[model samples]
Target: MFTEAQLYSPVTRTGDGDVTVHLSTEHPGVHDPAYRARRNAIAACALEYTSGAPTPRIAYTEAEEQVWRTVSIELARKHRGLASAEVLAAARRLALPTDHIPQLDEISAALTPLTGFRYVPAAGLVPLREFFGSFADRIFHSTQYIRHHSAPLYTPEPDAIHEIIGHATQLASPRFAAIYEAAGAAVARLRTDAALKFLADVFWFSLEFGVLREHGEIRCYGAGLLSSYGEIDEFRRAELRPLDVFAMGTGVYDITHYQPILFCAESMSEIEDVIGAFFESMDDETPLRARHLPTHANVPVAQ
Candidate 1:
C-alpha cells in the first residue's frame, strides 16, 4: 500500500497559522524555490482551517487555473465513457468547476449533504493511520497545490486534482462512501501494524486503483486511475486479474510508472459483497485466523 509521504508533499505546522511543505526533490518544479514556497503558503493557509471555519482560499494564478482547466476538461471527457456510473453520477452531483481550481471548502460543501464527507488540508504526507482512519468520520485530508504548470495532465504524486476530482467525486456516492467508512473502521479495529498494512494494500487495489466491469465494459473506479489523464486510458491494457485480497496485499510494484497489473471485479455488487464485506468483518484476528483456515474458506465467497 502507498504511504502518505509517497503520494503527497510533507506538511508541517509550526503554529496555528504557520504550515510548511518540504517538497521532495523528485517532485516536479521542486528546483524552483518560488514554486516550492507557493506550495508552502497554500498549505499554511489550509492548516488554519477548522471544522465549520471558512475554507482557506488561495488566489490561484493564471497558470494554475489553466492546469486545472486543461485536466478537468480532458478528464471529464474520459470520465463520460470510461468512469464507473457511480463516479459519473457523483461527479455530476459535485459539479466541480472546470474553468478554475475549486476551493477545498467548495468541494466539501457539495459532498457533505450527499455523504457527509468533508475535506481537510494536508501540507504533505498525512500519517497512514490518520489519513485512512478519517474516513470513519467521512473526512478526507487533501493537498491545496496544483500540479506543475508544465504537466497539467500529469502529476508525479497526488495533488489537488487527484484529491478533489478523483476522491471527492467518489465520496459523493453513498455506496462508495459506505465502503470507505467500512475500510476505516476495519483499520481502527486492526491491532497489528501488519494487519493495517494488509488492509491498506487491499484499499490500494480496490479503491485507489481498482477497476470493474460494467455492462460489458471495463470501467475505472479507483481515484488514481480516474484522475490520471495519461493512465486512465491505459488501465484496460494492464493484466486484469480477479480481485484477491492476498495478492493485492502482498504484490509489489513501482508507483512512479503506469501500473502494469490491476485487479478487476466482475461488478459493483462484487465490490460491495466481497471487498466491502471483507472490510466490515475484519479485525486484528481476522488475518491471523485466516492463515490457519483452509484455503477454500479464505477465498471470496460467491456473492
Candidate 2:
C-alpha cells in the first residue's frame, strides 16, 4: 500500500489551471533482466526523467501471483466485452501472452513489429514533451507495472492496465497508426511544452478515456476507462459528448473523478484525420498551459 500521505494527497495537476494532469504512479513496468540493464543503454543520452537527470531509476514491487492474476484476468475479460472485435482478433493473432499478469516486455514485443509501436516501461511519470516524443518515435511510454492492489478500482495514474490496454490496441488500425505518428511528428517538429500538453489532453480524452461509435452502437475502448470496473459502467451508460466539447475545456480545469463529460469522434478515421490536421495547424503554437517539468517531485492536483 502507498503511505497514508500518498493515498490521500491531492494529485499533482501540472501546467495551467484548467487541465489537471495526474501522475499515475512512480513508473510501473517489469522488464526481463537483460532489458533491465539494457533499456537505458539503448536510450543513450536521450533517456531522461527530468531536464537535470539524464537517467531515471526504475522501481519494482512483487505482486503476489493472485493479485496480478486477478487484474490480468479481469482485464482480458473486459477486453473481450469492451474492446473491438478487431483488437481482440489482433490480440489473438499476436498470441499476446498475459505473462504473469504480463509486464511491458510482453506488450512491447507484441506491438513493436505489428505497428512500429513499442511500449517503454516508464521509470516514472514523464512531462508532456517527453511523453509526446515517445509517440513521435513509435514508442508508447508505458508503465509496465500495475498499481498496488490497494488501489483496486481506480487510480490517478496509468499502470499496466492503462498502458497496454488503454492505448495500444488502437495502433492495430493503420489509419489510427498514421494519425498517431502524425500527431507525434507534429509535436516533435514543434517541440515545446505547451503543444505537448494540448496533445496530452487530446490523448486523455480520445485514447485513454474515449468512447467510439461503431455499428450503430457505442463501444468501450479506452484503456483508462476499461481498466476501472466502476468507471466502465458509468462511462458506457453516461451521455456522450463530442470531442470538441472537451477540447474546449483544455487547460481551464483539471479533470478528475469520472469525467462527467466525454467527447466521441464520429469515426476513428474522421477523428484520427482531424487530429492529424489539428496537430499540423497548431504545429508551432505554444500552449497556454505548458510549463517546465520539475525533478524528483510528485505534486498532486487540487480536486
Candidate 3:
C-alpha cells in the first residue's frame, strides 16, 4: 500500500494560522507559484472546517473548471464502455455536473438522499484511522484542491476530481456504500496495526482497483480506475484473477503506474458476499490467522 505522504501533498499550519501545502519536487504544480498559492488557500478552507457545519465552498478558477470539464467529459465517455453497470447507474442518479466543479455540500446533498453518505473536507493526508473510520458513519473525507492546470488529464494525488467523481459516485450506490461502512466498522474493531494494514490492503485491492465480469466483458468499479483518465484505459490489459481474500489482503502493489494485477468478482453479489463479509467479520486476529493460512504462501507479488 502507498503511504499517505506518497499519495498527497503534506499540509502544515503556521503559528499565525496560515496554511501551506508543500508539493513534492515531481508534482506538476511544484514550480508554479500561483498554483501553490491556490492549493494553500483550498487546504486552509478544509482546515477551518468543523464537524456538522456546512461543507466549505471553493470558487474554482476558470483553469480549474476547464480541467474539471475536460476530464469529466472524457471520463463520462469512457464510463459508457468501461465502467460497471452499477457505477453507470449510480453516476446517473448522482447526476454530478460536468461543466463545472461542484462543492462538497452539493455532493453531500445529492448523496445523503440516495445512500445516507456525506462528505467532509481534508486538508491533505488524513490519519488512516480517522480516514477509514469515518466510513462507518457514512462519511468521506475529501480534499478540495484541483490538480495542476498544466495537465488536465493527470494528477499525482487524490484531488477534488478523484474524491468527487470517483468516490461520490460510488457512495451514491447503496451496495457500494454498505461495503464502505462495513470496511469502516472493521477498522473500528481492529486492535493491531498489522491487522489494520491488512484490512487496508484488502480495501485497496477491492474498492480502489477492483474489476468484475459483466456481460462477458471485464468492467471496472474501483474508484481508482473510474477516476483515472489513463489507468482506466489500461486496466483490462492487466493480469486478471478471481477474487481471493488471502491474495488481496497480502498482495503487494505499486501506486505510481497502471496496476499490473486485478481481482475480478463474478458479480456485485460476489463482491458483497466476499469483500463485504470479510470486512464485517475481520478482527485483530484476522491478519495473524491470514498469515498462517496456506493461501498466504501463494500471494502474488507485483511484477
Which candidate wins on TM-score?
Answer: 3
lDDT of 1 at 75: 96
Clashing residue pairs, candidate 3?
Answer: none
The ten-residue window of minimal lDDT in model 1 covers 294-303
RMSD of each: 3.2, 11.0, 2.3
lDDT of 3 by residue, 159-188 (tens): 999999899989999999999999999989
Number of clashing pairs per prediction, in order: 2, 19, 0
For 259-293, candidate 1 gives per-residue lDDT tens digits of 98888888888999978998999887766665554
Go through the candidates in order and give each one's C-alpha lDDT.
Answer: 0.83, 0.54, 0.90
Residue 155 lDDT (model 1)? 86
List the candidate 1 regions with Cα displacement exceeding 4 Å. Answer: 12-20, 50-52, 290-303
**Local lDDT at 13 for model 1:** 71
Cα deviation of 113, candidate 2, in Å: 1.8
Give per-residue CA lDDT, model 2, range 14-121, as digits (tens): 254222222324422222333233333323222333332322323433443344566666767877766655556655655544545455556666677777876654
Report the alpha-carbon TM-score of model 1 versus the true structure: 0.91
Order the candidates by lDDT, highest first. 3, 1, 2
TM-score of each candidate? 0.91, 0.67, 0.96
- The candidate that wins on lDDT is 3
31: Cα error in model 2, Å: 26
Could you tell me which 10 consecutive residues in candidate 3 have the lowest summed lDDT? Answer: 294-303
